[model samples]
Target: MSTTPLEAGIIPLVDAAPLIIAREIGFAEEEGLDLRLHRAPSWSSLRDMLALGQIDAAHMLSAMPVAMALGLGGFAERIDVLSVLSVNGNVIGCSLDLAARMRAAGYGFDFVDATAAGRALIAAAGDTPRIGVPFPFSMHAELLYHWLGALGVQAPQALRVVTVPPPLMAQAMAAGEIDAFCVGAPWGSTAVEDGVGELLLPTTAIRAFAPEKVLAVRHTWAEAEPDLTRRLMRAVWRAGRWLDQEDNCLTASEILARPDYLNVSSEVVERSLTGRLVISPRGDLRSVPNYLVFFRGAAAYPWRSQAALMAHSLAARSGLDRAAAVKAARSIFRTDLYRQNLRDLGAEMPGATDKVEGAMRDPTAVASEAGHLILEPDAFFDGFIFDPTGDE
Candidate 1:
């Protein structure tokens, strides 16, 4: 079979596993796609590459396409999120000095309680705590804002938000550029490995099902090349499904650790995959089930609600019209295209395109065409449920 060549941009993080796995494990090849994965230096560069048509698609931050639609990132191009590639894979860590201070202040790094962690961090970190995030328009930023704001930190206003690439997070911490960071694994694990920082909490503790990275493409490209878009989405979806299996963790980690990919140790990558993370240099392990989700519980489904929730936060922060921002953001997540492409492949199609974000607190069955779709817990730590339909 003759395959159509396609290039996709990705940052070197463990969450980029689906795209790498698709190419290495023959999913992309089986779908008649010659997928070329490019490792971008940072999320900003990857976003620009997708916007400028340097790549056909990108493993992007879930909030990126929304931010572009709302005219926040200074990029004029319209990008569509084809699917959610990964979810809740971020870790919030702090420098060794701050960790020591928090511990001295009696804050245990429980790695489960977002409220406790946030309050402790606020108290430990000075009046203007510097926090590093992979990108400004990222779930890491959004999660940090929500987590800190709920704990009375006043968020981005009162805090110093620094933009540091994931791979450089440890270095930034060591150089004292940032007192704390919210980054994707295994970079957060890298900080622990390097003994520069210690993991405080996984972002999942803040928002249980935050969409971390997305499979994104130029809106025009997706519209013009429907067949190719469908093939790529299906290929990546299959890769995510494979990665979701418990037995495939070791192999997936090994593949992701290749030099062409993350280039980190396979063991470090495996920690994120298995959700058994070492939180400190002392080898204190924390078992966080579903810490990083690729395909289970409609993890690949790009729900419009997720985009709206992100838009709601972005608009409030950027002084944009909230309702208009949400309206624009919802269209970027292509639920219709998701159904059109993956319906026949035995992929469970959720009956609803939009739901109340942060409403599900447990693995609850929801309406779906297959009638057996149970969504994972997606509650925010503050118990806030965002109704996308009621945005007005």
Candidate 2:
């Protein structure tokens, strides 16, 4: 079915930085399609917009696509999750009050030893700690959940879970509404610089190169627009490669901080993008690369292991079926789309499928099974509320 070129509209956000940069920077144009970028109010707002066909696709949360597939979200008439937008760009932050007390009680940048670090942080909190997350079905919430659980503290018992918008996280912390927050770029970096909070931990240390977000579209829409989907993925893939360029980091940072995008200061965006995070007043901003990965570095290969880990996470949290959970998750996390994107750009695929660990101590391995990349799911979780109708 042929349609008007550039007829599709895409919604944007901080996580959508790459897609925005891809368009503003020409990767979208190279695909020979006209693109429209729209800003959404929130995740559910964007999901509803995409599901209603108000937009062709979206810069979405990694779990958003799968959540829709499993009817874990609104108007859950299944949708096809096409590709990853970026990876491992999130950070765990704590307020100055909490940070000081933790330091006074002996908790520092101990990324590898997540278990002990979480216990100490929680212990530093005199009573129930109020932590903010961007959304209910976000990597922020899941990562925080797993990391805190490492200390034998479940999200419900150990602390209070608060839903603060990404943009408002820093302000909420500064106001003492939240003691800590798990969030993606700019905001986390913004908090630390504004003297409201401290970025005590990088998510990479918690979940090495974890899948952070993706491009999602209605499954029926994807089936009908196969060529468009391929073209779209290729365009974003090229954009990813461009963003990964060291020199382009500054330029990309400028694009993300525009009022139409993250709506924060460019200085704040650069802090996260250029690997310079402001820890405190007296010291320098620590280097954290690929903070806001877009193109290939973050968006390039859709690791099967990343998909499996999301399943393990959702299963562990919600008690969904692990095997069935794996199937449903794999249905949306499309590596096939990723391959097309990489091929058009003439980029060689990653030499080998590597094992990635999520927030859990367990490792997720990737292997070829039945011509598909198979990632190992967690065995410990057997209880989750899964609707079988969505299972493929």
lDDT of each structure?
A: 0.91, 0.67
TM-score of each: 0.98, 0.83
Can you tell me which runs of candidate 1 are displaced by over 4 Å? none
Q: Compared with the true structure, what per-residue lDDT tens digits does model 1 show for residues 1-392?
A: 88999999988888888999999999999999999999888778888888999999999989889999999876989999999999998889999999999999999788999999988888988888899998899999998888888888877689788998777888998999999999888888888989999999988899899899999999999999999999999999999999999999889989999888888789989989998999999999999978999998999999999999999999999999998998899998999999999999989999999878999899989999999999999999999889887726
For model 2, residues 245-315, the per-residue Cα lDDT tens digits are 88977887788887777777777776676656676654545776445555533345665655666675676
Q: Which candidate is the best by lDDT?
A: 1
Distance from true location, Cα of 352 in model 2, Å: 8.4
Model 2 quality (TM-score): 0.83
lDDT of 2: 0.67
Candidate 1 has which clashing residue pairs, if any? none
Total clashing pairs for each candidate: 0, 8
